[model samples]
Target chain A: MLTINDLARPGLEPVNLEISAGEIVAIMGPSGAGKSLLLRAISDLDPNTGMVMLGGRAREAMPAPTWRKEVGYLPAEPGWWAETVGEHFQNWPSQQDSLATLGMPGDCGDWPISRLSTGERQRLGLVRLLEGVPQVLLLDEPTSGLDADTVESTERLIRDYIGTQRCCLWVTHDDAQAGRMATRCLRIEAGRLAEPTS
Target chain B: MSYITLDYADLAIAASLVLISGGASLVLRLDIERRLLIATLRMVVQLVLVGLVLKALFANVSPLWTGLAVVVMLAVAGREILARQSRPLAGFWAYGLGVSTMAVASTLVTVFALTTQVAPDPWYHPQYALPLFGMVLGNTMTGISLGLDTLVTSLTRERAAVEAKLTLGATIHEAMRPNARQALRTGLMPTVNAMAATGVVALPGMMTGQILSGVEPVEAVKYQILVMFLIAGGTGLGAILAVLAATWRLSDPRHRLRLDRLAASRD
Candidate 1:
């Protein structure tokens, strides 16, 4: 299970939540509603005061790299560092399954990052995140740039990955996507998170 | 053969050359005539003052005087480094890192050269020590400031990419490797180019000065070569130290990018 207790940062109210195994929790909010900040706090990306535990292991107990490895956070517009797609991945061949499921071409890895379209970068970013098989995934509008068909495939890929062991906190503005993917949906306004009224 | 001494009248002839450029600026409406004149005046006054100070120091030849000169050089270099940056670190680090790195690098290299190679009656002889320290400090200051400016700017521009790497479980050092490499290259490029172009493209100022002072051509060449090597070592060491230290300060122990430590841009 992934647990957040009283997690707080500037511009974000204190939050307490728990996501057990095989759970997909969708977070919906208007722009600048601190949805991304909440995810970043859980992933320990931004400076925040929080007690986060993954499978009962405290986030602060381990090295940051180790914590981040197990709890991956993918931004809305993922960043690419290297010249080519393959360079960013540890073993491109090993990520073939994830890449194929996301409908990425076999030669996608050879393409330069600059040449890749927005949707392509988003899909590749997803594939890159799943390569590590993090126990908790913090995805920020992971499919905001994808076409309808690609979105379905991307959603299916994530569902398949989150089968029974992992949990995900997906931030999206799409209500339909929230209905389709989330086991529980929550809303955030300003910096405060609110439980579903229903 | 003795070197010819230039009196005040001889200097006036050289000073007249500035008027040619100043007059051109006025004609072209470049509006830089005043700035050019002020800069020329400042250079004259500063160099003349230093020349007078050196005359006194050379006569006295005390370690305490040499130490004071070294301190002043380092302080000025530190201020220059801070001023040269578009976005320097906030607070003490802005001055402390560059100043300390240059102080250590230049002093170590200068002292090593003076003691092992150019041993005068006293190793701290102001004539030898001051000039060597000044040259090394000046070059190192340039290298460090350039390296730091490039480093802070690159980090700001590439924040997303660096943070992305950090999110992917890369250590801080691993995340910073590419940027650091670029900054170090920028810092060391000038010295490398100067070394490459020393004989063919340009006679270095030190060699030219020594030659004008009637040192044998071969002897001046040897001294210039030694000075070049010392400068390269000092510059490289100072740049590496400064770049690494600044990188460390820009991040946290949790491997997070602490860009908040950078001061607001002046312009």
Candidate 2:
């Protein structure tokens, strides 16, 4: 379970939320809303005042890297550092199955990052995030660049991965996707969270 | 062999050569004549003042005087390092890190050479110690400033990649390792190339000055080689120290990239 209490930063309102084990929470908002900032604050990537607890353990209880490992964040447009895709992954052999599920070829690991298309990068980014097996996933527009067919497969893969022990906070602009994936959906407007009227 | 002393008339001839360029710039309306004149004037005044001070220092030969000169040089070099940065560290760290690293590296190397290699009647002899320290400090200052500028700028440019690594559970050190390595390499490249090209493509200024003053070619070559090695050591050490300290400062203990610590770029 992931619990946030009074999470606040400049330009962002205090946000309190809880996601139990095996639940998916979709966050929707208009452009310029603080959806991304909320995710970053929860990941402890940005400076904000809040209390975040994962599985009865406080975010500040352990070192940041340890906390980040447990709470993996997949940015909307993920960044790649190394020359080849394989260099970024810790255990290449173990991730092969996950890569295959994302429709990536076996030799895709050896391909240069410059050569990977946007859809390919998005899928591979998801595969990389799952490599850590994070208990809480913070996904920012995870399927923004995917085509219809790839999006369905990707959503199914994410649903299968969120087993009995894991929870997810997904940010999306598509209302249909939120309806399809989220156990509960909330909307953010100008840094404040509210229930969707519709 | 004895060398002829250059008087005011000889210096006047050299000054005229600069006048030629300044005159050309004036004719073409290049607009640099004023800056050139001011720069020339400043160089003459500064060198003359340094010459007088060195004469006094040589005569007195006290460690206190030598130490004072060293302190002034290091302070100036530190300020220069901060000034050269496009985006320096905010607050005292802008000056503190570069100045301290240069002081430690240059002093250590110069003292090592003075005690072990060039032992005068007194190890603290200003004639030996001051010149050695000046040369080491000057080169080390350039190296450190270059290293620091590169490290900070590169980290800022690669902020996303670094944050991605951090979020992937990499420690700050691990995330910054590549940029630090690149900065260190940039800082050391000039010294390394100078060492490679010495005696072939160019004659070093110190060796040329010594030869003009009647030092033997072989003896001058040996001194030049020693100075070159000392400079390389000081520059390498200073650059490494600066890059490491900067990397540490740019991040927090939680491994977050604290870009807010950098001053905003004026441009």
| Residue B265 shift from truth in candidate 1, angstroms | 3.4
Candidate 1 positional error at B91, Å:
1.6
Candidate No. with top DockQ: 1
lDDT of 1 by residue, A158-198 (tens): 99889999999999999999999999999989999989687
lDDT of 1 by residue, B127-229 (tens): 8999999899999999999999999999999998998898899999999899999999999999999999889998999999999999999999999999999
Instruction: Assess the local accuracy of residue A70 in candidate 2 as a C-alpha lDDT between 0 and 100.
Output: 93
Writing each residue's lDDT as its tens digit, candidate 2 over B30-128 gives 999999999999999999999999999999999999999999999999999998898999989999999999999999999999999998879999999
In order of appearance, the predictions have TM-scores of 0.96, 0.94
TM-score of chain B of each: 0.95, 0.96
Candidate maximizing lDDT? 1
Best by TM-score: 1
